[model samples]
Target: MKDPANPTSRTPEDDRLRRRIGPTIRDVARMANVSIGTVSKALNNNGSLKAETRERVIAVANALGFRPNSLAQSLHRRHSFTVGLISNDSFGRFTMPIAEGLEACLADRQIAVFMCNATDDPERERQHVEQLLGKRVDGMVITARRADRRPGLDGALRGLPVIYVFSQSDDPEAVCLLPDDEGGARMAVEHLIGLGRQRIAHITGPERFEAVRLRRDGYRQALTAAGLAEGEGYYLSGDWSEKWGYDAAARLFAHGREPPDALFCGNDQIARGAADALRERGIAVPEDVAIVGFDNWNVMTEASRPPLTSVDLNLRALGREAGRRLIAMIDGTPMRGVSRLPCTLVIRESCGAKTDTLTGTEDYA
Candidate 1:
């Protein structure tokens, strides 16, 4: 019973369904009174057009809810617009921040990131690398939980642009981004010296680690610079754990031996353990023994008795820099050598620094 003059009158639901389908380039061209080619040029900023004409076309496209097809655009540009992120950090302690920073930098460029965790398995890592290669990613970023040097992926990479983060490759020409651990350790020791504490002991991880050696060298350099000598039992090397720190602290004070007035721990967990040990032995923090830690981990630093003052590795910034360098490398720019970014010292009650009332956080770069 449809009337000839008003056959199939549109309903609100019909209009809503039509809107969900979205507007096309042809719709935009018709509304803007321009050709489809002109609309494409305006959207991509590709061809000669007057500024006023470009603005008008763009305004029409925006009003119509027009969106370009990313897959088609990528095909036209001959790029997959994707990057691969490979990590051996199964805990995500170091990988998360770096990934966030990298994503932040690449978001504006419409690049997608594929993350793969290879754990400690060589076969798994190889499989992940092969998959990423099959996808034809524009570039790749490799990171690890530790800051040690790892074997390069020379055979697998096939000349793809790659950057290392929080770790280095054994390859001499590989680009690496890491925190300045030596400089950070020196700053911590110097701060303790400035606080009038002469006997500064270093409690660190195993001697096999390059970081441990570098930090120890920095601690020794600071002590020597201030005309202070390291006593027989001032440097202790053990496993990187709270239990190790607790045991080390007890050994330092046993047998009526002189105790260090300040303790510079390799990590926050060790510093917290040492603090607990000192508390049980009836020693007041800052008044009798001050403590400084590394890593600036919020869980350990903020939960400690006086809140630890520790070195921040600036991992996120390192990731951002890595992303920039990778982009440049993908664009045919050559990058080489290692780059060490400076760390910042977050000041809190642990280091005897007064906290800022407004922010409750202060740092020294």
Candidate 2:
């Protein structure tokens, strides 16, 4: 839903273009039996028009799909009314819904979005940034994998009101919007604890990524809070993909020591692969070895034979918030650094066992 306080929806320019095509003020005035000036006043809310006549004109305009030329209006006012978006390759899938939600919210405010996929390449990202600047976008938002560490971004956007979405690096100067990774990790681990699995192993993404690092931290925190010392051998690092998940799971299963009673995968893709590996080894999920994943990516998790337990990172919210913040920055309102959105746990059949069954699994940090 579009927040009323900030009406900055996705692609404000596109929506305006849709409205500008038909039913000019002349047409509306003709239909309402009023002067074009009256119709203009009614549409723009600029000057006084008879209330009854205004209603009639509005009604006619509505029937005829008459819309104001927001792009032209913003141009006349010396505002680009456009936001630049730079995203990474993996996070690209999330851009659409977020963009859609943003557009829906910003409909009344009249703003538009310009998007670019940087594919995690510094040079390409730099080029895209330059292109957006050339286009005179009013503000910019980036769904960066490494918000602070990206080369040239800091210097390039020094004076621009830029907001980072999805991930943030260690630098404090970056204004960012991200999921509550710690909270999400805690939610997933606690769900496993609740399911009575004590010997839990984690297959995590590359430590270089901030979100992954936080999720790993959250897992350790959860284990510590429960009085369990996390095993040194319990963690496996891998790429955020199903192939890596499968490889890690196989490695764990083959390692001679007692197999972990459960697994916490870094993301849904890894979890899916882990599940396949377990199934291939004839291990029944939840009943034998439980599994939990991050990122509530619905395609695989929701449709799996036995649905997977996962965490919802609120990625769409992250996108929408980024858009809202970008609009604010363009409007000369600087937002606070580091805005975080809460994530929720989604339970399924993956962790079905009772919590008390795992005797040695208490308080591992």
Candidate 3:
């Protein structure tokens, strides 16, 4: 199934728009591998973090030129530079990074964020929107739980300068920012081909997800480009779970002759499952098979025995873009449609790479 999403341009202007003025707690939290609130508590000596963790966080904060006094304090301006953040995702894995990215961009300008979790509930969303508007927040950033337009969303958000993250509105004129899923998937599969792996196969998430279709297209395009599209069943669809990977990989090897030498997974979890299944069958990773995953999630990527090579949708950049776009709109700049950020391929051991090979992110410099 196709996703109800669109893409936007990540041109040089977008990059410059995300550049901000000063350092904030968000900066320190990122440098110290902690949360923004954690940084505050650590600096004030008010929390229960491990001694070493706190110290490390402090050192990192200092190194990054962070000041405790500046934490959550607005710039010396007359107005409170507050913005409302409405998101339907509570898991934080996706929403948190995006929020942090938006915070980073806003923090540069000394803007405070008031976050409201909609939890995919329309009533809650309306309530939060009404509350933010009542508080007279400068503007708002809204994101859907599944990155698709929801009912009453447009109506509830009617008079505010709004920017949509990872989702779009029914209005063709709305400003949205989404990750380039098609491009990211293409980058991953092409990297595998570049590594001299010909017998490549793909296993991805539910067919209902637009990500699944886009990544699959990327995989197929890469294969066809290399004149290797003749293979059958090299593409498979399954649920977005490690168990699906395990089952799918096991079924492929049931043939017991000439299995694929490289596997491209839709997400990190499936990659881990596929790896585990391969290992159980005495198949050596990167020796007999190479793997690449999407999402570039650190825990899953790093925890795998050889680590995983995956795609990073750069939620931080996405959020930063959303914030910048909203600020521009609030400042009387004309904005329309989706502004898409490119995805990056972060290389690790699972691909048998000698060095990190990032495709769509940036130069090594």
Candidate 4:
């Protein structure tokens, strides 16, 4: 029973008492029926306690909605608990889900991330790497898909924990996380071949990139396995742009050698461009020329006039795996330096092939 004019009293976690009755470790310890030393050890992760007791302390803290002061924790451990991320623009599109997964993964460990886009420029990449190093990030995740040579960050990255996501270094010793691009290409080409597309043509990016080389090798391997020859005129080199794909298609048409019944594009942008060029030339897709693309970017494919069939690189899984492996590395757990995730195919209207009926025997082209 209280006076009508009086307001109800509230705990520190609610109402006006929140700041006045400050929540402290000692308070938490008392509420949790634990010793001050026990609370300190549990909060700082400095001392070991019984498993049950540790869990109980954490549960009480959470129940009280206690937020750890990161500054205090950093001061106590002398660790910034921050990770650096270096990326290119393509990686920005392909690595967003992975980045989100990484953030979620690191959040469980109470770590923060600092992301920087270098736009695939060597100078900008160098500056960003240096800036992240200057901040003394605990580790770094590099997603340089187009980085040909080691940038100026190599020397600084030495002895620092690093994980390559969506890309690889020329050096085999570097820790790398990438999807099985060759296998993915094999799946895509084989799918096309199963649709009777023996005269399949490939449109890919500059041959300088490893992904390109691997994908090309897979394509060749699939053709060879099927006893089909990928003729000299069957491949075209173009940049990873829709316009480049369109221009490449025009070049193919100009050659006047038998046009391929089906085209396997390096990526979705190229596929879209090639499709547009074919439509402009009055060639019907699937009926006249079937098409396939990689990187299942829904934003690009879903809204196309005729939805494009593409391969799913599982970028989110790629990012999640990279974050998981990096965490293991930071925890001093033994880990496989290079981890390759799997890929899937997204069936759409562009490819005239049915996934369920194909056992590498059917022919539609």
Superposed on all Cα atoms, the candidates' RMSDs to the truth, in angstroms, are: 6.0, 10.1, 17.5, 7.8
- Give the per-residue lDDT digits (tens) of candidate 2, residues 1-365: 55677777646665677566766778788889999888878877778777888888889999998887765666666777777777784665566656665666555577778878878777888898898887667777776544334432556865777777765535567776767777778777877776677888999888877778888888998898887778767899879888998999998888567888899988889999999999999989878998988877789788754788788766676677776666777778856567667777777788784322111121211
Which one wins on TM-score? 1
Q: Estimate the TM-score of every prediction.
A: 0.83, 0.76, 0.76, 0.75
Model 1 ranges off by over 4 Å: 1-39, 48-67, 108-110, 356-365
Q: How accurate is candidate 1 locally (lDDT)?
A: 0.86
lDDT of 1 by residue, 1-365 (tens): 34578868776776787788788889999999999999989999999999999999999999888998766776788677889999999999899999998988888777889999999788999999999988878899999999899999855899999999998899989988888888888888888898799988899999888888988997898899999999779899998898888998888877778889999999888899999999899988878999999888899999999898888887888888888888898899998888887777787888776752111122322
- Pairs with steric clashes in candidate 1: none
Local distance difference test, each candidate: 0.86, 0.75, 0.81, 0.78
Q: Which candidate would rank higher by TM-score, 1 or 4?
A: 1
**Clash total of candidate 2:** 19
Error of 1 at 104 (Å): 3.0
Candidates by TM-score, descending order: 1, 2, 3, 4
Candidate 4 TM-score to native? 0.75
Over 4 Å off, model 4? 1-66, 75-81, 120-136, 145-149, 152-154, 254-256, 334-339, 354-365
In terms of lDDT, the best-performing candidate is 1
lDDT for residue 262 in candidate 3, whole number 0-100: 94
On lDDT, the stronger of 1 and 4 is 1
